[model samples]
Target chain A: MWHDRAMSTTGRRVGRPRAERRPDSGLSAREELLAAAAELFTVQGYAATSTRAVAERSGMRQASMYHYFGGKEDLLAVLLEGTVRPSLDLARGLLAAEGSAEARLWQLCRSDVVLLCGGPHNLGALYLLPEVRTERFAGFARMRRELKEAYGRLLADAACCTALDAGEVAVRTDLVFGLIEGVILIHRSDPDRPVEAFAAATADAALRVAGAREEDLAEVRARAAKLAQG
Target chain B: MWHDRAMSTTGRRVGRPRAERRPDSGLSAREELLAAAAELFTVQGYAATSTRAVAERSGMRQASMYHYFGGKEDLLAVLLEGTVRPSLDLARGLLAAEGSAEARLWQLCRSDVVLLCGGPHNLGALYLLPEVRTERFAGFARMRRELKEAYGRLLADAACCTALDAGEVAVRTDLVFGLIEGVILIHRSDPDRPVEAFAAATADAALRVAGAREEDLAEVRARAAKLAQG
Candidate 1:
């Protein structure tokens, strides 16, 4: 199921040859444009960021950008895709993997935090920008909903052993997402902290939000370790 | 301390005459511009929202808006102040009022959620816009930090009796703020739910984030009730 969803959504063939893919370090014109566009969009915002500025930032001529992207909106679409696709792919993989629900959630939370914090800036913060909420970005919104639903399913599974009902599960799922995303906001305020610490703390907080009992967290942590090894 | 900070920051005299204040219904042209600007800025991105549009939306001439605000940036500053001042005042009141730290934190969380959800759009979300994070809005950022400090103080006081240490209190403070702010994001995704229900649930979830033990939650809820009555 995960493989089917990933392949369909991203249009990538299964087991594609890595040799055909370009590296992310501005080696290709397309990747260079994307890297430059992401920085500009995040710093100056979507409405204020222009394709011309993006080209200049990428050390390419303004006219060449049109060959790569049709316009500014297309650049933004690609950037949003860059942010959402990897998380969705990881979520699908984890949801399909064999492990207890608690352990799976821990893994998801940790990886998500690492992604949000490992970036040059808190790129996740880009989602909160007003421009992204408009109709043109409806696809980003849909992808976000898919990620939330993935969290919802894992949370529901984890809550099955506890006294939490369906309604509680739904509310807790949203809160847990907020807890994870909140780390990005915190990093914005204090960026000097270690990313590993934030990831570990967020995973622990996610478990608590999912209603894992204190005594049970030890076992859940052990399971997470085993899952990480696999 | 809270009172002093709030008063100095907002620059309003205590016990000011109500008659000195302009009514909020656009009865005054300045109020009209503010109302229209808030709606426009919340609906359209700030960079996309023009002062001319704000004036047209308010049924005034474009030149008339300049009498109220110098430009679009000034209009945004006013709109942001409108969002932050009321909450700062409320936080100050709650901090200065008589109650346990737990009860005050509950009141703050519940009322903040109510304010965020009660608006036609999630005005609290305006803070997340990339445009708002720039140098022009440094004052807004400082005000936001002050608000977060207010929350931190309350959480620290509440955690005094618990096993939570200084670092835990700080982490929990950020998480609780995120949980509270997340309500706005959730409401954006699912606005049909009752505002009161979201407020109640958020308040409960905040207490959980602040390290309230299950056994202690009953008393905290009772205190919240008493605080609400007063």
Candidate 2:
């Protein structure tokens, strides 16, 4: 799942399966610092969390943490790039196909829902991280901005292909994202609701609100019915 | 304008109308504490920012802050109530009237958009507060669940009144709330965007997705077009 070529650094390994299987052994200290930072920032938050805490958590000396990442903000930049860049790249590639706008959007929403929910915890931690919004984390903020733009472009393309208005596209994007967020919020509220089920419901709702044609609606109902029967 | 009850909480004055006319001295110490807590939790992740920092920022003794809020978790509860309760009450009030599903939903969405944009900064800040997800602020979490239920009931009623499918109602509510949150997020990111424009777009888009009849759509379009032209 790791995309080494995705990194522009000259010496970085590209498509090396061995490197991905044992990143702890393969990654430069900088990469390890970022992984550690992502976990800490997501769990303890950026402000209350400190470099020393990250160093201790990652089993490194505090001074080494500083050498790899100038400070907490730089670690945030690295973590955000790891989380957001590949997600957008994957979305852009998946969305670049000929299909019904409804179908294309369904595909896109599914990918996001999976990314958000297919974890021990939802990606809300990353999205809601305080550091990402602060001036000190401007690099991460820029990445977030670009990610949104990329998603918007995908939605706009779907709208054009499907004959939906620009305003409608905005509505569709908001509904899909909000539904995903809401489901994750609900899952966090009650762990009993499997994220996958909610993710499926979210994808269904997203396609339906995009004004899926009758055939598409019937297809989804059939799927839901099948799930019930099975 | 504040509700009469809210205004009365501070009381008019012990003496005469002349004294009441004098601006209430800047935020009371308690008020400053709440405000500081809200801002800190919003700007820094709740886990990252300490109650001590809030106290220091507000220039109040940390122990004194505990007197008002009890603890950091309690502070989150108060912040959410300050932001969420009024909106739920307003939504319930709007749902009480008799109208077609479209009209009723439009009213709720309109009010929600207005309320959301009314205090853009605090609204987003209060929402993405990290502590909100943890059970540490159960009261605040209950308020959110109740708010969602209130919105859900209104959507269900509209579905019954308009003859829409139950599934469609679920989808519509998700879509409507999505538009509300999305508009708020957009306006927060670009504070210069006129709140009125965002509200109108939200209302119109929601109406469209809710499957407003041609007559109702025409009415909304006319009103929206006039607003835009003006």
What are the TM-scores, per candidate, against the unseen true structure? 0.84, 0.69
lDDT of 1 by residue, A86-193 (tens): 778888988899769889888888888887778675576666556667788888888878988999989888843367788888888887887776665677677787
Model 1 chain A, poorest ten-residue lDDT window? A13-22
Off by over 4 Å in 2: A1-40, A58-71, A94-96, A135-139, A159-187, A190-192, A195-197, A207-230, B1-29, B44-74, B133-136, B160-184, B203-230
List lDDT for all candidates, in order.
0.73, 0.57
Could you tell me how far off, in angstroms, the CA of residue B74 lies in candidate 1 after the best superposition? Answer: 2.3
Cα-based lDDT at residue B159, candidate 1:
47
DockQ-derived CAPRI band for the predicted complex in model 1: acceptable
Q: Global lDDT for candidate 2?
A: 0.57
Query: Cα deviation in Å at residue A5, candidate 2?
Result: 20
**What DockQ, on C-alphas, does every prediction get?**
0.40, 0.24
Residue B73 Cα positional deviation in candidate 2, in Å, after optimal superposition? 4.2
For residues B1-230, write the lDDT of model 2, one tens digit per residue.
Answer: 21232233467422111111214447666677777776777666577668899888777567555545567877777777765677677666655645444555565566666766675244454465444667776766676666666666766765332677777676556545655655544544555655665565566556655555324555655543443244
